[model samples]
Target: MSRYPDVYKSWQSNPEAFWAEAAKAVDWFKPADRVFDASQGAYGRWFAGATCNAAHNCLDRHVAAGRGQQPAIIYDSPVTGTKRALTYAELLDEVEIFAAGLASLGVSKGDRVVIYMPMVPEVAIAMLATARLGAIHSVVFGGFAANELAVRLNDAKPKVIVSASCGVEPKAIIKYKPLLDSAIAMAAHKPEHCIILQRPMERAALIDGRDLDWSALVDDMRAQGAKAACVPVAATDPLYILYTSGSTGQPKGVVRDTGGYMVALMWTMKNLYGVEPGEVFWSASDVGWVVGHSYIIYGPLLHGNTTIIYEGKPVGTPDAGAFWRVLSEYKVASFFTAPTALRAIKKEDPTGSLISNYDLSHLRTLFLAGERADPDTVTWAEHALGIPVIDHWWQTETGWAITGNPIGLGALPVKPGSSTVPMPGYDIHILSDEGHPVPQRTLGNIVVKLPLPPGCLPALWNADERFGPSYTDEFPGFYKTADAGFRNEDGYLFIMGRTDDIINVAGHRLSTGAMEEVLASHKDVAECAVIGAADALKGELPMGFVVLKAGVTREHADIEREIVALVRERIGPVAAFKTVRVVARLPKTRSGKVLRGTMKKIADGIEYQVPPTIDDPAILAEIETVLSNRPVVG
Candidate 1:
């Protein structure tokens, strides 16, 4: 039985007591010795003595109890249009054999294995195998360039690397093996073995000794009579070290231990997505990011739910209709995606009936993260998909959503642009620039206070001093989110945007998001990116690059006038962009955040690496052309 309490309570009044109850909610074989360990480190441990296998909790326990015949996975091919339904019995078999194959190659407990493959079934198998054997899995996004991949591989020094020959995206067929070969070629300290998947089968100039065919490798293992088994490891043993995207600089590897990650992750299942037993949930995020790690991969699976692990982009091979078709095909009860994808696809098929094309009657929740979800997207989802869009706030460092609205449980007055409330057990206080706590309604950096979150990484792996300075030491007493926000008089948390994203216009500090949301609402604009451009006098001013929908002409004067008027109507004239360049599209990452830093470099004539992450690299060139040809208007 479950004693689920009322929504808005003093969840933090007794933090340890509240967490202890949560730790018991899931299946735990051996209990933890302590619930909290302050002396251990900041954001101290919960379930400190817990010794359990994550793979068993997710797969084995349910399957061993006659639930093996149940549907465990529902996969759809990106191009072939084939459907593959995996039962728990079959999934367990795959995990077991894969674990054995890894062991055969000398990948054992405490060793690192970097997974650089697509979102195929094998990727999940590799992850489970690593977990089952007590090895730390560092799964990097397959699409990252060789430079990025090599940096992570060098950092972790994984014993093995698993990559695909090639992969797919919306606008291109990514040949990843070359990058893998290039990385291995350049590695001064490389992994002992490299396994390659043969889907979409294309090979490059091969480095024969380092790489081997993946299908041949795993197939050989299943023939070896591998059975489901979990190696006993310390509760404190690391499970994975997912590296953060290096939007600023070199990526930092985030270490998630066995006990803390599992405990914090399980709560996310029942609470965040409102994931119920046997529900079909789907989060449209890559396993590369934290959202995928928490919601898409771990949270849903932990709850014994059949979730969707999509391979292609939301807008690939088709338009916005593609997403709806999948939702209709799977009858997804919970659908999640980033705001950029929502903005992009909605323009391609704006009738919003694309949602109706599918049988979405089962859908109860639509979750959005990676970037702030605008009110228009929420209203659109409600009217179109017929589900409430629950906007949440979290970051790579935090590991899971820190501030978000729970599903139907705590409905404070619905603010159009606010995330509404801090999640239970997360203490949030707005702090001034100097780190002093600020009064309500005053915009400041949002900081998470003492009694830190367990889900939040124990520390950036091998960079404890880096964690102290970047997150903890700088602020003295709080984990400064780097995100800026303010609580209204009614206590709703309004996310103002990242402090780095703020722009100053004639001495007035303005959030680029507020301005962009108003611009995004323009009838002709499909999507727009607002970035802070270095200005001579005002320090920094807002510059926008917009992508208009089809049939919407590039009328510089008309569109510019309308946007300026829209800003005045919505906010004021001062908030208007001094420059609006109507272009084909904006540059964005795979997780769907606009690459403002890339745009900033372009604006400053500074050289930058246009990501291999975007669906179209040509769009950046289009934006550059738009900026070059535009007439200066001051």
Candidate 2:
């Protein structure tokens, strides 16, 4: 056995002794029949036979223990220009109202709802409502354009879409209604009803008969005598479907069941983040995406720990000091942010004491993710904030923090830029192509060897539909994390870069699918292709090549500016585009894929074969014509 028995002892040494202790650490509804289901597969079940509702763990258990009055969330709305505090009791009340509203819509068990809104309180409401009704929610990052949104709408076939007029940003306003209209128009199965939340932003007049205002729905629910819809649910039932960027022409919707997600989330929050009751925890991420869905909404709530949701850009209406202002304003106990913000902040105002402006005396920990974290970035935050900057790692498919320097586990021994050992009981390893574990220091593909945490996703939404082809077909048995990295001898995991087409721009992890989704959002755009181009400024900049709707002029930087602003407003300023190239058409494969490789060659100044399947080879000439006029940023 290793010197640290808890650290190195094998499962064979004492199986029950290991997982049983972990299971007890987290709050569960009922005891599980079995902890590990080996007969099923490597990705077997956890907390089997356990009955748990995510909302229950998030509120009831903590509230029952007299922590109801404890802070649950501290919200910031740009319209209000003030921070609003919410206790667990108040949050529960709000969630209850929305849950009942979802019930009012006849959203029941098994129905899937799409939550396509920015980081707002309503986003939380939609998720809890789904969990409360036992309905699965598929949260597409609100940053996506209409065509992308339409594709997902067609795939998931949601019964309803909960959206907002706009999610605030440092940039221009994003009118979501138009996209909703376009997406709804194209979707194979249109939602029976559309629920829209009009932020303080000036939205176009609501579509008559088709859209219902959110405030009106809440009003109707209030007028009626309705109790909280805190419906109980099974652990194994589907909770949410988060789509990952697809390399094979289509996005893969990864489904994570309720019980498994709860187990993993609760464990990570308490252990990985070292969250304590009443301590303020904030993730500077929009609920439109996974970090927001898991940590910002579910994880902290499950723990009854106070969570902070900021509804503006990190550098909103002011300098980068805006983030520090929020940190100081809330006295956040722990803060998690992407490295992209840190890099831009550092690059622009190097050697400045923006960290000093914030009274982070309560700041115990800082976590970084959404991209491969640069070591220097974390070190910078540490020096500036005078706190431990914990660089963690996980993906939308993983659901919650997997490998992290768990601060609450005692004095955390951290290696800057390394995602510390896998959270307890998670068997993580770096393997070469053949599925064999590589030596500790050698770089290789990242894969989870043992049964992953309960927080891990429940395969693609249509598992039988696309399972053997996308995920399992490529790497059998072990769960493949599509990033390239290796574990250090110290057992800390380090992510190098993406093994997929996805690009990490300014710390925001966005797939080319998501980027293309942004470009296609333009009113004058038909289809779009986004590829990563070299940039010393951001390491990689998303260069969007778009096919415009007929009659749109190409010389107009107005469209480029609008698309860039659209991304900024939709996904926060972090995802803003570096270049928006208006191309006549996208290079394609014989099968109609957006010949991304050809785009890559164009980005790299190399000639490549464009398959005979390209719908209009002339579009390539248009792309070349446009590029001849622009300067390529190296």
Candidate 3:
């Protein structure tokens, strides 16, 4: 009954033919000379020799197809108390005018434009407008520190910068213009011009002769009926340069091509998400991240589905009920978010009471990504919503999903911790340290056979030499995912954690994720993290940290004892999971990824730099105090 086996086989049989058939979904300006070119990029390039416009496909084609009246973007900001919808026609008009504004500033094909803004509709407009002129746009997360932004600026060397006055948070207004100015002042490369959007909450002082007002510029262009036509670019032309932080403290700008990206997104919108045109799809994420780029902006638009731009947290934009209200009001059919968001909501409500307050009949599926989705969180979400809580595996490098449950073809049986079968074009294999294929159900390194799928990053911007040493050189003829997981007999993939999370204990390799799963299953524990702490005898030993639920009044000592017993019973003593500690909160990135590596450094007593992406630096000090105050548990 499922089309997955055949579809996957079809791709495996002939990848080019499979992708060629999928390319029919998009409207290309010029047909590709080859389905794929082996001699082009690192490994290869998809849809080589083709000409296309990402913005045109995302905006103009929909407007011309009589779907202009449909809502293209619904901006929902619980923090600012603002909600507005822009139709396809209106959105297209806005983007074209903005494109013309950028053009007037001398931005042209191949020029890089750095966008530093919050979760506003203008961020999407900036990206699409840049793409409209065949320019590359790199969006830095608004919450990043000034030095981090400066690093990206130096690496990207954007010709122009687009930013806003401020970003509204739950309890405070962050003045972004100051941060943007500081970053520019710190960077070696200076942008020719800056377009600042002055919000009512905070008005920024614009630098004379170098800065332009966003409203005034765009309004003037609109008054003059200036609409920049979409420029045709080669399929291999870079659409955007998204910089992801590397372990070396240098940012790696990941390049995504236009035509191949569009094709991959279009295919996944229907097959992976199971959403149709005119329906609502909300990806509750920030525009600064890849999910926002692919889902909140491009994927839904290319599929003609209404997408929601949410500017609030999972818990405190008002309360835990915030997401449910948006889903009920917008009638969202397919919802996507990170598992950490669900964990926060579950920790707050604990009873699933907020969910029953709204009408959720229209909601069908919920997809979780961005990190490892623990079985506890998945089960909690499933029981709360009475719908499928699908945990899909992907990375920032790969724009879309590498493995997922293809609900469009037919819903596969739900496996609690496994991210169901690989989508077409991803030949996933589990390889040991020696590059030998491992046995089924044995944890090892996960890698994809090269000539990665269309939506994946081709290479790091201006770092072609580093790409090989960083990713492909470790294992020849494969793209290193850097994740350690296993494939079940049924072919489902279980992502234990990052490859580095696998610790050698007394000559046995154990997964910290597996131990964390046991810790999280305890009823009193809301969320947990497991890091391999350095041990003299065992090489490394697992240390557990957990945050308790909201209303739990139980003693921390009792709860910690129970968690240790659970892990010991489930994973056995070989895990060396003796150390356990209770913390008020886990330090996480703004995108909700727990900072486990930092915690490991603290436990090992090694000097560690505070990660720029951390949501709160103070939490790291709290973790340090907790580790220093108490001795390791038996």
TM-score per candidate:
0.94, 0.78, 0.99
Question: What would the per-residue lDDT of candidate 3 be over residues 216-250, giving only the tens digit for each residue?
Answer: 99998989889899999999999998988553478
Give the worst 10-residue stretch by lDDT in candidate 2. Answer: 1-10
Candidate of highest lDDT: 3
In angstroms, give how far residue 109 of model 1 lies from its true place.
Answer: 1.2
| Error in Å for residue 447 of model 3 | 0.5
lDDT digits (tens) for residues 344-407 of candidate 1? 7777776575665667677777777888877776677667765577787888877777877665
For candidate 3, report its TM-score.
0.99
Best of the two (1, 2) by lDDT: 1
CA lDDT of each candidate? Answer: 0.76, 0.70, 0.92
Residue runs of model 3 more than 4 Å from their true location after superposition: 630-634
Report per-prediction Cα RMSD to one decimal.
Answer: 2.5, 10.6, 1.1
Question: What is the C-alpha local distance difference test score of candidate 2?
Answer: 0.70
Ranked candidates, highest lDDT first: 3, 1, 2
Clashing pairs in 3: none
Per-candidate clashes, comma-separated: 3, 4, 0
